[model samples]
Target: MDFLNYTEGVFATNTSGNDSLETTKLPTSKVLLTVTLSIVAILTTFFNCLVITAIAVTRKLHHPANYLICSLAVTDLLVAVLVMPFSIMYIQMETWIMGKVVCTIWLSVDITCCTCSILHLAAIAIDRYRAITDAVEYSRKRTGARAGAMVAVVWLLSILVSLPPLLWRHFSEEGDLEDQCIIIHHHLAFTLYSTFGAFYIPLLLILILYYKIYKAAQTLYMRREASRASRHSCMTNGSMIPSSFTAGDGDIDGGPRSPDPISPPEKSFSEPSTEEPPREKVRASVKAFKRKTRRPESRSESRRSQLYQGPRISGSRERKAASTLGLIIGAFVICWLPFFVKEVIVNTCGSCSTSVEMADFLTWLGYLNSLINPLIYTIFNEDFKKAFQRLVRCSNYL
Candidate 1:
């Protein structure tokens, strides 16, 4: 038993020496990986800081929605500051260098921060769904206090999900796990619980809310299109009845009529007046007829179309907001789904495994969501972009 032993074809141990395991290092140069991770860490920190600063300084962004966005930015900022640096080291070194206490703290922060970030995404989705589907009610309900309450709940749930491993302390010897900071999966029940609470359920909620939001947006869009078509139809109908339409020589009070008969009247009908009507009198009669016959159909139709003005503007703004929310939700799912699904698969199937590289890639993909979030949610927002520009220019408040 004094001979060296290897497990999983990747980790090696020597029986004669103090217990230790040698994990295989990546074939690529460590320098490249280090540089890449450093860049990502810096970008994550810098961009998230920009979002925080932009929101803080922008007075216009002081609403409940932006408040939630600021909370999200804070979560991402903490991830960048507390998780990514150590994670980069872990990935490159292929082992944990931080001591037990630091390792525990790192893992907790990592899980808590990411969980909070995801929950914030769900909260934003719910906010958008309400804001779209029930604008008046949601507006009255969406206050800073409520947003703060939501943020509190998000962090509390995140803490709950992240604390079980630390509390259980499943490792038989602290020394054995000193080199690695990972979830202890032997506690299968808690692992599943934590994973479900942290990822699956939140994802389900987000999907449901966004689906509803999408339906509401589609309805609004269809309604607008229908109204537009109706307005067009009205215009066409109103235009078809020309204002210049004139009757043949007949009474103008009614529709077009036939001309008088050419045959002479009967002699018994009494002799017709021989004198011709005066030109002024005939023109006056025609003028009276035109005045009596002219209708204000075009004016009335114009007024009817004008009635849609308020709703049209409101619908446009709603469509814009829904589109923005759609983009945010889309980015969230694309960035996090793979990682969460992989996590579920790996944890659910005991024999399932993932290589260090694939695991890191998936984790980083999820982290990339933090980076994409600000770009979609804030940078793309007109008000936020204006505020950002103002901040950059050091412009005085209006």
Candidate 2:
């Protein structure tokens, strides 16, 4: 297999160029890659920074949902500033020039930031689901302390997961050969850590939470429809009964008075009293008060629902947000999957040489996942867009 050949070449060869590879000195490709990556890095960094600033400054944005968004922004910012620049530099150099210390740091930051980003996304999904599913209950539970604990746990887990690779991995120049970094006797361990800790577990949790949230939203909508129907029925019946009774009383009193000019004293005395106007005025006043009162109450209820139960509209805005997140996550999986697969194939078969160029390309692509997230969020989320625009406008005006 390709893995066997690659491993054999690495173990047996001392030269930089292996038999199974084609070396290139394409300055144009190098420049293009560097320029593109640099531009992406700058934009991503600036965007995420804006996200953090906007959330911090805007009190209305300071909620659990946006708190998680802030966390995500921070993670993306780290990736953009710390990870992406080095990756671009590495690609430009076409070799690991920074010694073992920098390499370890790079690896740690890369894993930690990516892991934290994924975890933050998962947390946001859960928060949104709870807001929609058990809005009242979620509001009561999602206190500052609770949010703090969640953020703390996310960072702690990210650090823990990132530490393992640095602990076991090292780089050394073997004779006159090019210096290469490799995990020491821990390929399987790294695979498991990367797969389960980063991708598989988080994806599973997100899918399940969103599914429940979707069902809960549907139930709430149905209940609202039913309540509206019943209220309309009651109003119709109430108005009809009052009008019919008033008309009947009017007819009976008028008919007797006109027909019997010389009416008996008892017959006149037995006639129903006409105090209906005052009673109707009172009823009308009560209705007017109810209508006025209900307006504010309805508004309050809507705000409450929005605050506790996630977004009000599951329309294009929401779908677009979901799609953006899904796209980033999907890209992450696709880009990183190759690296792991390459590692597994080489470890198991020991046939093909590890394509350093391909591996580097894939790794950088994976890091690019972080850079895309902030852009995705800003594009899909209107609140983020508005805040960003306002911030820009204010800056320009100032």
Candidate 3:
């Protein structure tokens, strides 16, 4: 009896000690998660705020086209400020931190801002397409007010897409609903509706617009290259003819350094005409070659002048559009597709099980897109880089 009692006491003490340690201490994984999320949130906030400041201060960045970019930065900034921190806290706690009201607000802002960011991409694509396809007309129309109106429309549409969930997304007074804050994954119809509206529809539009934009840009680039090749070929032929004539003269005139117009140089080959000497024949051939070479000078000059002046600025713009569009579409699709696809699969297939950890990871993956936006914008845009350098040098407001 004494030995049994001692064993029971030891087992109880060990179990109690473990329980206390478990409750008080966080694992390495959780600590890493917290640190990683905090860093992402901070970087996202800093980068996006830098973009806004750069745009505000730099005169060169003050273009109608860049206004849409500023709006995107604003949207991503809101996501970093309002959505990510709350999400990090909720993930660490393994439940919602704030009450239902705050949860509803946070979820709504998350959806609206993310949707707004996606819509901003679509809007910028349209702006680029118009600029490329109809540069003359669209330049007139691409004003500051026009970009502002598009930004307004994007926000309005995002809010409308997120509003329906509020009507049916009330937390219950009891059970599993009270502690968790998640999207309406149970309703297949709304899930399809929101995901399609927010991501898929805009994705389709981007695909079609970028396809046409790529085609137009390709044609312009090919034409420019062809004109250059033609000029180069004419110039090469002209130069070679002059060199061949110089060599012919040196061979004919006993290694004379220069050609004398009055004196016809000698040549070994004959034209087989009794009326003309070899020297006369060579002189006539030289004159004929000169005429042929000089004939194309006028045409080449006209083409060269046009090449120097025409489409130079638009070429840079088109290149930027091409490079930036490809990257934006790729990043957008990679970051958000898994989460939306998971939602679609789990919601449509009622028998599918949803893991909270999986859902949270996918949601944060989508949120990672917000962080990617500013990086893509600043890295690709030369104007942004200059402005950022200037802003960093003179950052009183930071």
Candidate 4:
């Protein structure tokens, strides 16, 4: 989140002199900023906690895919609880009054949690792609243990990506650092590694996986629709045959008439007509049996309801794939891309620099992603919606 420049930009305000004076005389803008960021922190925590609670309480939402969501919510919850408040205080005070120990903890947790959140998105994209593209095989593969393992991997990678900054920043012996909590990254390579590992690479992977999922969803949906259409047509044509067979069963009248050999040539034709009733009965019986055995819900709906619980997952899903794909991609990119891009540019270009205000804006834009994550992940799921409603109702009752 351009945090390297971010610390400097914010701290630069107080680094000159008179930190105690500035902290006491808060500006209107800083007060407004504090209020705004405090609300953001509160909402971020509230929403992510709702997500975790919803997943935990709702048995219907207990699918392997949802496990990843719960983990993401946990990571975002950490961001809100552990990271955002400190950032807001820093913004308000314009200096690091907190001790070095707290700064070390804050910076480490900040990078780790944010990196974990981004990696969780990538993991979710992979799980959905597998479910859509390989439903049966993936169904077996997508278990609680597997989801746990995925979460573990995401956290491991996050820690690995964040470790360099945490270790280096913690051990730094730079003087006059008491007023600042900046992680001064001297090597450009670390910036590239951490940024790409934390945001860029995962986002690129998610985009590609979602694209593949979109195509697979389209194919499966069309196939299911065609199957339903063919079944409907067969039933429609069979309806007429059932009516004709009704009297054929009672052809006690027709059979008796046919046996009257007053015109023997007619007897032969009537005999063939009598046999047609048995064949029609078999066909009608088979159709009824098939209908009885068929599931109430279609395979497509069942599979997709478990997969993401987003939409129809067939006709409407196909039509809305672009929108869903775009929203997911756009939210993440809009939130994170500019900050990372700025980070790269500033790191690579010696003279290029971003103002503190611009850097803070970009950083918060990325932090907003923690709030956005739960909404995007859970809003479409009816199970989660119902669970949230129940929770809210219970909360009100209390």
Candidate 5:
């Protein structure tokens, strides 16, 4: 009886110890979250890398619009490389193991990349608007020096915007716990910086640019339709004449009759033939119209060739590239808006109880934005998609 009691007590103790250890392990929820975020980071990194590679290698994609896409790819690639790895490590450990220097770098990279991306999107919109509305003038005016200046301006603005956070000591303080470099969120500063610099102004600019583009496109389309209708009317009106009338017929009111029965063949041929007269008139008119049209076409074609012959700007691929950029920017806004809104509420509403878990989840959700942009471009943009497929095929063969 004594032996049995002792064995039972040992078993109970062992079970209790096992239960305690299990409870002490990180929460299952946290483990799952870490796993999910790591997966997202890996996927985002891979996809952005592919985008960069495809754009770099493809000869046909060297237009100005492609330049913007390449810029976006670079930003996203930086996000995946600089920001995501730290994020995954932080999430997995449930702490930031990196020291202050590394944390500052991460924060700087995050802000710079994101700001540049948004700015690039705005630049793309502006480029497209110019291309569609002021196509002729833009073609004549936009030179390499001009485009280069624009790019430099964008980067300079991005750097300026990103610098303030780093300079202001927003990220210098160590976390209260062992593992993280937490941001010192000053409510007023956060509100002003994030709202004005990141979300509000950028979004407002995008809206205005897109609205203007839509209106301009509509007006141009209307004008094109009107011009086509007017041309058709002129052609129809010019073609119509009494079937019996001929150039040499002298049928005008009170006009004298021709003197000779021996009508010269040249004059006779020049006169509209009675049989199939309308058809012949239409054919002659069409031939004359085509001859006139050829001059403009040749000039435009020469100009287009000249423009493309120089250093490839990828600008020719503007429409698809612009749409791709818009999707990325739109995605960024959608993904990050909720978190920013939460930040605002937390800052303003003193009574609101915010949890670390909630903040982490939202942050990870924002990180997911990095993974989506490359995929969005690949799926929607034909040039990128083809380039991607070609790359894959090349890889498989190799």
Candidate 6:
């Protein structure tokens, strides 16, 4: 009996010690999570601020197109400042730190900012597509007022998508219900509505807009290449023409002229010609030959001018912008699709199982999209690139 009691005591002690050690390690993981969240928040704020500053300070970047970009940066900045910190706290604590009112506000801001960010992308894609395919019309119609209206509409739609949750969510007198800030994913109507509006609809629009943009861009490139090939052929044939002329200016008789019917009839007698070349005639012939020789050169210069001053140059710029937009769209989908998919699954399927940690990871991944948007949009832009260089290199001058 004594030996059995001793063994049980040792086992109990070991188990208690192990439990305490595990509890102690929990804070370490929490600290790591906190640090990671802080870093993400800082990066999101810093990069987005850089983009906004670059656009605002750079005079050339102050166009209707970049106005949309600035709006996107603002939305992302809000996510970093207003949404990310709260998100980090919730992730670490596994419960809401603020009260019900603050919780409601936070969720609203979260949805509003993310949805606004996404809508801005769709807006930008639309702008680029129009600019690519109907440049003259888009330039005529694109205005600050229109862009401002677009921004307003984006926020309004975001509010509509987010507000439904606030109506259904309530603070119950049960455990964690009052304290936990959660979107009421269990409500079937709100779930499908929010998910479809906030994600699915925007995704469909982006896909369609980008698809059209891609096709239009491809056609633009094909036309440009065809023009370039024709130009090259012209230049090549021009060079060969001169080479052939140097070999021989075909027969002096001006080759195979049809006989004029008004000429003397076939029976008319022809006198033997003893013609001598005159000095004035020789001078005029020399001048005319010189003009003809220079004519080919002048034509070549004109062709060169046309090659440089045609649709080709503008097409290249359009192609570059299209490629940049493509990259931004691709990155957006990659970052947000997973989180949106998870949200749809959890909300639409009542019996769906999801790990809390996995959900948190997906949420943060979507948040990281906000961080990347500025980098792709601004940094890849030539004007933005020069502006950034100026800002970094000539701060005092500005």
Best by TM-score: 4
RMSD of 4: 14.2
lDDT of 1 at 159: 86
Q: After superposing candidate 1, which stretches have Cα over 4 Å from the reference?
A: 1-28, 170-176, 225-326
The global C-alpha lDDT for each of the candidates, from Candidate 1 onward, is: 0.67, 0.60, 0.70, 0.74, 0.59, 0.68
Tens-place lDDT per residue, model 3, 1-398, is 00000111101112334645754675777789889988989999999999988888778788988899899999999999998888788767765557878877887887788889888989988888887776655667889999999999999999898777655555423214566565443665777778798889999998999889787766665554444445445554564221212221221002323312222333424334678888898887787667666755665675467556546755775777678778888898998888777766766776765555566667778888889998886787778887787777885542
Query: Over the stretch 110-131, how does candidate 1's per-residue lDDT look in tens digits?
Result: 7788888988988988888777
Please, what are the lDDT tens digits per residue for candidate 6 over residues 1-398? Answer: 00000111101112335646755778888798889889989999998988888888877888888889999999999999999888777666554557877866876788788888888888887777677666545666888998888888888888787666655554433224554666443555655677777777888888898888777656654554444546445565754221111111111112221211222222312222346357656666677667766865776676567656556665776777567767877888888888767666665665675555566677788889999998988776678888888777867433
Better by TM-score, candidate 5 or 1: 1
Could you give candidate 2's per-residue lDDT for residues 56-117 as a string of tens digits?
Answer: 87666777667777888998898888888877776565555777677667667777887888
Task: Rank all candidate structures by their TM-score, best first, as comma-separated numbers.
Answer: 4, 6, 3, 1, 2, 5
Candidate 4: stretches off by over 4 Å:
1-3, 6-11, 15-26, 171-176, 235-315, 395-398
TM-score, cand. 5? 0.65
Q: Among these predicted structures, which one has the highest lDDT? A: 4
Candidate 4 pairs with clashing backbones: none
Clashing pairs in 6: none
Model 1 Cα shift for residue 219 (angstroms): 1.5
Q: TM-score of each candidate?
A: 0.71, 0.67, 0.72, 0.77, 0.65, 0.72
Worst 10-residue lDDT window for candidate 4 reads 252-261
Candidate with the larger lDDT of 2 and 4: 4
Candidate 3 Cα RMSD (Å): 16.2
* Alpha-carbon runs more than 4 Å astray in model 2: 1-25, 170-178, 181-186, 233-354, 378-381, 395-398
- lDDT, candidate 5, residue 246? 23
